[model samples]
Target: MMGESNRTTEIPCEFYSDKYPDPSNHPITIVLFTLLYTFVFLISFAGNMGVIYATIRHRSLQTVQNIFIVNLAISGVILACLSIPLTPVTHIAKQWFFGSLLCRVVGGTQAIGTFIGTFSLCAIAVDRYFRLVIAPGRPLRKVNAMRITMIMWAVSIVVTLPYVYHMNLMKYSPKHGLCGWFCTEKWPSPFSKRAYTIFVLVIQFLIPFSIMTVCYHAIFSFLRKRAKTRLTSIAQQANLLYVLAATAGRETQQHKEQMTHLLDQKKRVVAQKRRVTLILVSMVFIFGITSLPHNFVSTLMEFTDSRDLLTFYKTDYTYIVSLLTHLVGNEPDTTVAPFASLQPLHSFVNRYHSAVIPCANFETVFIWYINEYSGQFSSLAMLSCVTNPLLYAFLNPEFRELVLNGLAGVSWANNFVSKSWHPTQTTVL
Candidate 1:
C-alpha cells in the first residue's frame, strides 16, 4: 500500500489547477473522506466529553478559568465537526451542494468558528496570566468578558454577510475546464470584492492575531516575575519550616517523610505539562502560519481586479497544500539545504563526521520519540489535555469534587457497557 501511494509523487499542479479536486462527486472518495472525518470527530468528541464529564461531576471543577476552557473545547469541537468533512469536498470537486444562500451561511459559520477559536484562546491566556502567573486574587468582570466575546462574534458574523452577497455557485471558468460552485461576481450590487479582501485579512485574522501576540507577551512577563517570587517563597518558607521542625515534638516525624523535597527541585512532576503549554500554543501557531497563504488566495478572488492574484494563487496553492500536509501527517523534507554558512565539508560534518541534518533531523527524531513514547507516557504526557480540567478543580474545590464524582460515575457506566457487551449473541434456530 505504501509503495502504491508513493507512486503519486507529483504535488498539486497549481493552486487554482485541478489537483485533487472535489471528492463529493466521487462515490469512493466521498465515503473515505466522510469516514475519516467521522472518526476524527468521534475521537475529539470522546476526549472533550470526558473533560466535560469530569468537570460536571466534580463540583470543585467549576472555576472561571475552567469555564473559559469549556468554552474553548466547545468551539474547537464545533469547528472539527463542521470543517473536517467540508474541506475535502471543497478541494476535490469545488462543488458546493448548498447554493449561494448556503454558501453565505457557510461563510458565516466559518467566520464564527474562526472568531470563537481565536478569541477563546486569547481569553484562556488572559485568565491563566492573571490566575496562575500573577495570582491576582481579584476576579475580572464576567460582564466585560461576555461583552468582548459577543463583540468578536458579532463582528465575525457581520464580516461573513458580504460572502452571502458575493458567493454564487457557478461552473468554473470555461477556460479552466472545471465545473463546480465558485464564489464569483454574481451579486455585485451590495458587495465589492476589494472590501471583502480587506475585511477578511484585517478583521478576521490580523486583529485577533495581534491581540493573541500581546496576550502571550504579557503572560510571559508575568510568568518570569512570578517564577522568581514563587521560588524565593518556596525556598525561604521551606527553610524556616525545617528549622522550626527540627526542634519540635513527635508530630514533626510524620511531616518529615512527605515534605522533605530537595531545595533545587523546583519542578513538581504532576504539574510538568503546564510547562509544555507553551509548546501547545505553537499548535495554534501552525494553523495560522500554514493557513495564511490560503487566506491570501481567497482574498484575491474576493477583492482587487488583479488576475495576477491567480498567478500568485497557483504559487501559493502548493504552499497551502504543503501546510495542510503537516496536519494530515504527509510531511515533505522541508529542509533540502545545510544549516550554517560553514564549508561544504565543514568540520561538524567532516572531522568527527556524522552527517546529521540540523533542526529538521532533530525534529524528525523528536517526532519519532514522541510517537513511540506517547502511549507508554500517556498518563504523564496526556495530562496536558487535562490541565484545564485540573485547573478547574484547583480553582474551585467544590466544582472539582463534583466533576471528579461525575467522571467516576461516567467511567463506571462505561465499564458496565463493556461488561454487558462481552457476551456475544447466538444465532436464532
Candidate 2:
C-alpha cells in the first residue's frame, strides 16, 4: 500500500486517478462537451465546404478575395475534421489512444490549419488595403492571390514540420491503472522547447496579428476619410442644384431630381462600405481575443518554471484564502471535536495532504492547473474554426448568396429520390 501510494504521488499530472476526479468524466460534462464539439464540427465542415463548392462551381465567385476566403475555409475544414473531434476525447479520457504516426499527423495538421488561417486573414486584410487605399481601380489578380495562398500553405507546412518531429506518443502508469498513454512534444532540450514555443507564438500569432491590425486600421481610416469627402461633395452638389432651381424652372427641377438620386446612391454605397469594414474589424478582433489565451498559456509554460508559479500561488494570501474556502467552506464545524477546537483545522490539513500534496508536487500542481483549466481556454481557440466560416464566408453578401443558391440546387437529388420512392398520380380523377 505504501509503495502504491508513493508511486501514485510520482505520477504526472497529465494522467488522472480516483484521488483526482476527472471533471470530463462527469455525465453532464461529457454530454455538453460532446454536443459542443459536434456542433462546431458540423457547422465548420458544412459552412467551409459550401464556400469551397460555391467557388468551384461559379467562375464569377473566383475573385482574388474569394480565393483567400476559400483558403481560410480549407483551413477551417481541416481543423474541424482533424483537431476538434479528437481533442476532447484526449482530455476526457486522459490518454492518447491513437498511435505514434497519428500523433504526429494530427499535431502537424492542426498547426498547419492554424497557420494557414492566420496567414490567410492577414493576406485578405493586406489585399483589401491595397485595393481600397493604395489603388482603387487596380485590384489584385486572381493568379496573384493563388500564388500567395500557395506560399502561405508551403510556409505553414515547413514551420509545422518541427512540431511534428517533436511530437511523440509515450506510455505511462497512472495511479490504480495498469498503463496509460499520452501524446505530447518531447523536445531535445529545455532550450529547444522554449525556442519552438517562442517561434510559433511570434510567427503564427503575434506577427500575423500585428499585420492584420495595421492593415485593417488603415483600411478603416481610409474608408472614413473617403466617406466624409464624398458626403461633403454630395452636399455641395445639392446646394448648387438648389441655387440653380430659380433660374431655370423645369430643367433645374430635372437636374435636382438627378442630384437627389445620386446623393441617395452615394449614401447607400457609404453605408455598405461601413458595414463591410465593421465585419472585417470584428473578424480581426475575435481572432485576437480567441487566440490570445492559448498563446499566453503556452508562452507562460515555456518561459516560466512551474516551481515559480507554484511559489506564487502558495504565497499569495488571497489565493490561499480562496482555495481554503473552496476546499472546506466559509465556516468549519466546531462540534466535530468540542474539546479540541483545532481539530477541524487539523482535518483540513490532513485532507489537503491526502487530496493535493500527494497527488500534486509543485510541478504536478502547476501542470494539473494547466491541464484542467487551460484546456477550457484551448476549446475557445478551436472555436475560432467555427467563427471563421460565419465571419468570413456566411456574413459576406456575395458568398452567402452563392452558398444559398448551391444548397437550393441540391434539392434535385431529393426530388429524384422522392419521385423514385413515391410515383406521382396523373389521372383525370
Candidate 3:
C-alpha cells in the first residue's frame, strides 16, 4: 500500500502508526467538533441541493449568471456529500480505516471539488463584468456558457491527477508494536510536493481572489457613474414639467401619470443597483474570510523549513525516536534513529528537506495543524457551502420565489405553504 517504493520515512510512520490518540484529551472538544461537523454536512447538503433544484426547475433562473451558480452548487454538493462527512470520521478513527484506493479517490475528489468551486466564483465575476462593462446589451450565448463549464471541469481534473498519484495507503510498525494503514502522500519526488502545494495555493486561491477584486471594483464604479447620470436626467425632467404646468395654469392628468411612472422607474433602478452591490460584496467577503486562513497557513508551512518550526515545537523527531528505542530496550544507532519502525516517515521527511530546498513534511505539519484548528476548517466548509444559496434567497426575489414554489409543489408540504406568492420581476440592466 506504500506506493511502489521501499524508501521508508519514520516521521510520517510515527504520526500514523499509533492507535487513535486523544490528542486534545477533552471530551467537550470532541463533542463540540462532532456536532459542528454534523451540522455543517447536513446544512451544506440541503442548501446546495436547493440551489440546484431551483436552477433546474425555473426557466427564469437559466441566465448566464445562474448557470455559474449551478456549477458552484454542483461543486459544493460534491464536497458536502463526499468530503465533509469524512472530517468527523477521521477525527474519531485517528487512522485511515478506508483502504488505499479510497484514499486516492477521496483526496483527489476533494481537491477537484474545492478547485472547481473557487474557479466558478471567478468565472461568475468575470462573466458579470464582461456583460455589464465590456459588451453591454449582448448576453453570452447558452452554448458558449456550456462550453466554458466543460472546459473548467476538464482543467480541474487534469490539475487534480497528481493528488491521486501521490496519495497512498501508509502502513508501518512502531516500537510500541503498532501497525495499521494510514492515508498520506508518498511523493515520487519530494520536491514536487512543494511545487504542487504552492501551485494550488496560487492558482486556486490567490489568482481567483485577485480576479474577483478587480472585476467587482470595476462593476461598482460603472454602476455608480451610471446611477448618478440617470438621477440627474430625472431631476431635469421634473423641473421642466413643473415649468410647463405653471405656464398652462394647471397640471394635466397625462402629465401626472407620466411623472408617477418616472418616479417608479427611478425607485426600481435604485433597488436593482443595491441588490447587485450586495451580491458582489457578500461573495467577495465570504470567500476571502473562509479561504484565506487555511491557504495562508499552508503557504507558510511550504516556504518555511522544518528546522524553523522544530525549535518552536522543542522536540526533534529524531531525538524522540532514539528515546523511544531506549525505552523499548534497543541499542540506539549513532547515525540514524534506532527505530527501524520509524524508517518510512523519517526517510520521506529527510528526502524532502535534503533533495528540495529545505521545507517541512507538510503532511505531518498539516495534520497537527488540522488537529489544533479543527473547528476552523469545519466552519469554513459550512459557511462556504451555504453562502451561494443564502445570498440568492436574500438578494434575488425571483430565486426566492422559485424556491418557495418548488417547496410548495411537494405534496405533503403544499397545505401549509402557498404556491401563489409572486413578486414583480426585476430585470437586470
Candidate 4:
C-alpha cells in the first residue's frame, strides 16, 4: 500500500501497469532463488526452534545473556514466519499478494527484524564484555535480562513505528497493487528515504558494529590472558604434585586415578569454553560479512544523490538489499549454520525434548517457531530470520546446553533422530 498523499498518474507507471503483466518473469531465476529461499528458510526454522528448545529446557541457560539471545531468535522467527511462505509469489509476480494490512505487516516486520538481528548482537557484545571485564562471578540475572529485552523490544517497535503506522495501500486504476514491502518508506521528506536509511544503517548498524568490534577485541584479549594463567597454574601444580607424590614413598593407584579424573574434567571444561569461543569468533566474521555490504551500500547511498540511491535499491546488484531482506533478519539460520557445523552440539540438541521447555516462557519460543515454519516473506524476511540464535546457541555455552536439554524433553521425533544413533566408534575411543 502506498502511504500519505497519492498523486494519481503523476509518476510514470511504465514499469508497473494498470493490468497485471502476464507471467513473463524468468522462471529459472525464480526457481533457483525459490530453492535458495526454501533451503535458507528450512535451516532458519530448525535453527531458531532449536535455540528455543535449548533455552527453555535447561534452567542453567536462563541467564541474561541467553534470554537476550532468545529475544533475537524470537525476532528472527517472526520475520521468517511472516515472510517465507510468500516466496514463490515474490519470485513469480514481483509484487505483494497480501492486502494492505499484510503489506504493513511485512514492512514493519522487515524493520523490526533487522533492528533485532543487528541490535541483539550489539547487546550480546556489551553483555559479554560486561561479564568478562566487570563481573566474571556475577551473570546478568534473569530479571535484568527481562528488563533489557523489554527495552530492546520497545525500542525496536519505536523504530518501526514509521512503517507500522505511516504505511497505506494504494488501489491504482481499478487495479490494486501493494508496493513498498521491504523496508520501503512511502512518504518522502527533506531526508526522505535517506534519513530513515541513515537511521537504519548508521545508528543501527555502524554504531553497533563499532561497539561489537571493541567488545570482541577486549573479550579475546581477556580470554587469552586467562587461558595462559590457567595453563601456568596447572603446570606448577603438576610439578608440585609429582614431587610430593615421590616424597610419599608409595604412590597409591587410587590417587593417580583421582588425579587423572581431575585433569580430564579440567580438559573438558577448557574444551567447552573453546567451543563457545569458536562460536563467538564465527559470529563476528558472519556478522561482518552479512552486515558490512548493507552498511557500505547504505553509506554510499546516503552520500550520493537520489538517482544513485534508486539505482542501488532497484538494481539488486550483489543482491545487497535482498541479502539483508532475506538473510540477517532471520537469526535462526545464522546460528543453525554453525550448529549444523558443530556436530557435537547438534547431536546433543537432536536428543533434547521440547515439552520439558518452560511452558511459562515459551511464547517467545513459539513466536520464533511459527515465524520459521511459516516462512512466506521476500528475501528481506529471510535476512532478519537468520542471525540471533547463532550467537545464543554457539557464542554462549550455557544456552547451548539448555537447548540440548530442552530438545531431549520435547520434540520426540527430533529427540530420537538426533540422539538415537551412537557417535562413530572412533570418536568415542
Candidate 5:
C-alpha cells in the first residue's frame, strides 16, 4: 500500500502481491542490511550516550553549544533506539507487525526527534553567530540555553501531533487470504496530505537550512574580515619595528623575540579561526547532504501519482535490466506458489489462487523494486545521527576530552585517555 497508492481510500493487500517479491528479502541483502543497521545503532546510541553522560557528569563540559549538542544527542539516541531497529524488518516483511499503538508512537517519536534535531542545529548556529559576531567573547548563558531547549521540545511535540494522528494501521487480506497489516498515513484528503507534506518540508528543511546558511555565512565573513584587519595591523607593526632596528644600526634580542612572538600569535589566531569555520561549515554541509534525499523522495511521492512514478521508473533501462537479471539469476523459480504449506487454507487458496497470478507481471516487479530502493534512500537520513556524534568527537577536542575522561574508570580506556590528555591547550574551536 505504501508504494502502490497515494489515495485516501483503503487498498487491498494484493497491492503487496508476492509475485513482485521485495529485493530486500534476498538472504544476502537481509544479512547486509541487518549488519549495517546494527552498526548504525551501536555507533549512534553509544556515541550519543557518551556525549550526554559527559555533559551531565562534568560541569566544565556544560557550555551553551554543548547544551544544544546534548539535545541533538538525545534525539539521535531516540532515533537509534526506536527507529533504526524496525527499518530493515519493515522493508523485508513489507508489513507492520507492531500494532496500532506502536504505529502512532513510533511515527510521532520519529517526527519529534527530527524536529528537535533540526531546531537544535539552528539554535547552535545562532548561538555561535551571536557569540562570535554579535557579542564577541560573550557566550550564551546556561539558563537561557535550557529555556531554548525547552521551547524546541515543546514546538516539536506540537508540530508532530497531526502527523501522529494520521498514522493509521491498515489491515487487509491479500489474494492468498492471509490478513496483513501496514502502518501508513491516512489523511482525510489528498489536499490535506499535500499540505502537511509541504508544511513539514518547510519546517524541517527549508527554514533551518536557510537559517544555518545565513548565520554561518555571516560568521565566516566576520571572522575573515577581523583576521585580515588584525594581520594588516601586525604587518604594519613589524615594518615599523624593522625601520627602527635599521635606523638604530642594531636589532635588539628583545625586539627580534617580540617580532617572532607576534608572528606566531597571528598564525595561531588564524589557524583557530579557520578550524572553527571549517567545523561549522562541515556540519551544515553534512546536514544538507543527508537530509535532502529523503525530503526529495517524499516530495516526489506526495506530488506525483503512483502510476506516474511506476511509469517513470519503468523507463529507466538500467533499473529494469538489473532487476530482471537479479531476479532471473537468483530466483530461478518465479512461479513459487503463495503460502504453499498452509494446508488449512487449501479451499480458500484454490478459490482465489488465480487472483495472485497477475502480479507476476513486469509492472509489479518494477513497482516493488522502486519502492524498495526508495525506502532505502529514505533511511539514509538516519545517517545524520551517526555523523553528528562523529563530528563532535573529531572536531571538538574539549568534548572529546570530556568523553575520554568519563570512560577513564575502565583500565584500558583510562590508559589511552591519560596518554592523550593535555588539559592546558583548550583546543575547543
Candidate 6:
C-alpha cells in the first residue's frame, strides 16, 4: 500500500501559487492577519464564557432556551480556544506544520464545534416553534432539555468523524524542498471525498437551514392568526350589550380585578413569545448568512474539474516523472528535460493522485479559496459567537437584569445602575 501510495511525493504546488501571501517576503500581511484572528479569538472566548457563567449563575435564566444557548457557548469557547485560534497559524505558515495526530485532533475539534453550534441553533428554533405554535402553555422540562442537548453533541461527534479519520499529516520531501508540513485527507477514492463533501453540506447545513425556515414561518403564521383572533374577539365582546345593573356592587369589583390580572398575564406571555422569537430568528439569520458561502463553495467544488483548477509550477517535475514512470508504466521521454517548467504536471497530479490516496479532490479552486479566506470566514463566524451573548442580554430583560445586578457590587459606578433598577418579572416586548 505504501509503494502504491507513493504518488504524494509530488512537489507541493500550493507554495508556488501567487494567491497565498508569502509571510517571509511580506511580513506585514502576517501581522495584520494575526491581529485579526487574535481579536476574534479573544472576543469569542470572553463573550461565550460570559454567557455560560451568566446562564449558570442566574436562576431566572435557566429556561430551556438558555440551556441551548449555554451549550452553544461551550462550543464557541472550544472554537475560540482550540479550533479558531489555529487558523491564523495556518494562514501565515508555508505549510501545515502540525503533525498528523494534531492535525486530526484540531480538524476534528473544529468540525465538532461547528456541527454542535449549528445544530444547537436549530434546536433552539425547533424548541421555540413547538412552544409557541404546537404546544402552547406546556413548558419544556429541564430533564428533557438535558437529554436533547446530549443528543445534539453526540450526533455532531458521530457525523464529523470523517474529518478525523481521513486527515493525514504530510511532510515535505527533500525534492519538494520547503513545502513544510501539511494536513490533508488521504481518502481511498475521489468519489468518497465528493460524497462526503455533499453529505456534510446537505445534512449539516442545508437541512438545518430548511428546518429553521419552515419552523419560523409556521410560528409566525400561528402568531399572526392568534393576534387576529384576539382582536376580533375583543371587538365582538365590546359590541355585546351588557347592562350595568346586571352585576351591581361587590361582584363587579372582583370581576374587574380578575379581568385586569388575566389581561396582564396574557400581555406578558405575548411579549415573552415575541422577544424569544426575535432572538432565535436573529441567531438563525446570522448563522445562515455567515456559513452559507463556505458550504456552498465546498459543495460546488465536488462537481468542479480539479484538472483545470490547479496551477502547476516549474518545481513539479518530480511528481510528473514519478507519475509517468510508476503509475502510467510508460517510458520517460528523453526528449523533455527534467525539472523543466511544464503544464502537464498539473494534469498528471489531478488524474492519478486520487488513485494513490483518497483526498485528491481537495486540490481544487474551492480548496484554494478556503485556504486563502479561511481566516476571514472563521472570523466572520466567530463574530456570531460574541454577538450571541449581546443578543441575549438585549432581548431578555431578565438576563440583562442579572448581568447588571452582577455588575452592581463593584463600585459607585455599579451602584448607579443598581439604584435605577427595579425588579420585575420577565416580560417580553
Each prediction's TM-score against the native?
A: 0.56, 0.73, 0.72, 0.64, 0.76, 0.68
Candidate 4 vs. true structure, TM-score:
0.64
Q: Please give the lDDT score for candidate 5.
A: 0.60
Q: Per-residue lDDT for 206 in model 6?
A: 86
Between the candidate structures 1 and 5, which one is better when assessed by TM-score?
Answer: 5
Using TM-score as the yardstick, the better of models 5 and 6 is 5
Candidate 6 lDDT for residue 189: 76
Spell out the clash pairs found in candidate 5. Answer: none
Better model by lDDT, 1 or 4? 4
Going through the candidates in order, what is the number of backbone clashes in each?
A: 30, 0, 15, 47, 0, 6
Best candidate (score: lDDT): 5
Q: In candidate 1, residue 388 scores what lDDT?
A: 30
lDDT, candidate 3, 62-145, per-residue tens: 888888888888887876665555544443434556676777776666667777777888888888789888898788888898
- CA lDDT, every model vs. true structure: 0.41, 0.57, 0.57, 0.49, 0.60, 0.53
Write the residue-wise lDDT of candidate 4 on 139-205 in tens digits. Answer: 7787877887788878888877764554544322222222222111234443444455456556665
How much lDDT does candidate 2 score?
A: 0.57
Q: Which lDDT tens digits does candidate 1 get at residues 1-429?
A: 888786675333222225333222356745765676566556555555655666555555555555566665554455444444454444343335556665555544544554555566667667655654455677656676666667757765665555444334443332323333343223333234344445555754576567666665665555556556767776776777677777684447555653466343355421322543443355345435534533443343233223222124333232233213312421011110111101110010011111122223433322221211111110111112223333322233344334444546566544433332211101000
Best by TM-score: 5
Ranking of all candidate structures by their TM-score, best first? 5, 2, 3, 6, 4, 1
Candidate 4 residue 360 Cα shift, in angstroms, is 54
**Per-candidate RMSD vs. true structure?**
17.2, 13.4, 10.4, 13.9, 10.4, 11.9
Instruction: Give the per-residue lDDT digits (tens) of candidate 5, residues 76-119.
Output: 88767766666445545555678888877776776677788889
- Which stretches in model 6 have alpha-carbon errors above 4 Å? 1-25, 227-281, 306-380, 392-394, 411-429
Better of 1 and 6 by TM-score: 6
Q: How displaced is residue 234 in candidate 5, in Å?
A: 2.9
